[model samples]
Target: MITNETKENYNQCQNVNCSTTFVSHETVARYIIKPQLINVLIPNG
Candidate 1:
């Protein structure tokens, strides 16, 4: 069901910088939601 609570959490708006503007969370989600490797081998022996 489409609820206001979920809308507020996912569709919230905010400024990324000092500029007087607004942006939706979905914008950042595109850059954040992705696959990545966490573990890595160290070069030192």
Candidate 2:
């Protein structure tokens, strides 16, 4: 039921700047997932 695909627009790790090294995964997940959850919860938008 799981697949490797991405439809959402997000800043990706290019390995050029290595910006992600400064941020924790939990923070990143919340940054991405929380917005999606809000949209799903408020579908009427």
Candidate with the greatest TM-score versus the true structure: 1
Q: How well is each residue in 1-45 modelled by candidate 2, as lDDT tens digits?
A: 122332333365778868453432222222444334344354675
lDDT of 2 at 9: 39
Lowest summed-lDDT stretch of 10 residues in model 2?
A: 1-10
Instruction: Give the per-residue Cα lDDT of candidate 1 at 25.
Output: 31
lDDT (Cα, tens digit) per residue for candidate 1, span 1-45? 134222322332355664454433322323446668888878997
lDDT of each: 0.43, 0.40
Model 1: weakest 10-residue lDDT segment is: 1-10
Give stretches of model 1 more than 4 Å off. 1-33
Stretches of candidate 2 off by over 4 Å are 1-8, 16-45
Model 2 TM-score, all chains together: 0.14
Each model's TM-score? Answer: 0.19, 0.14
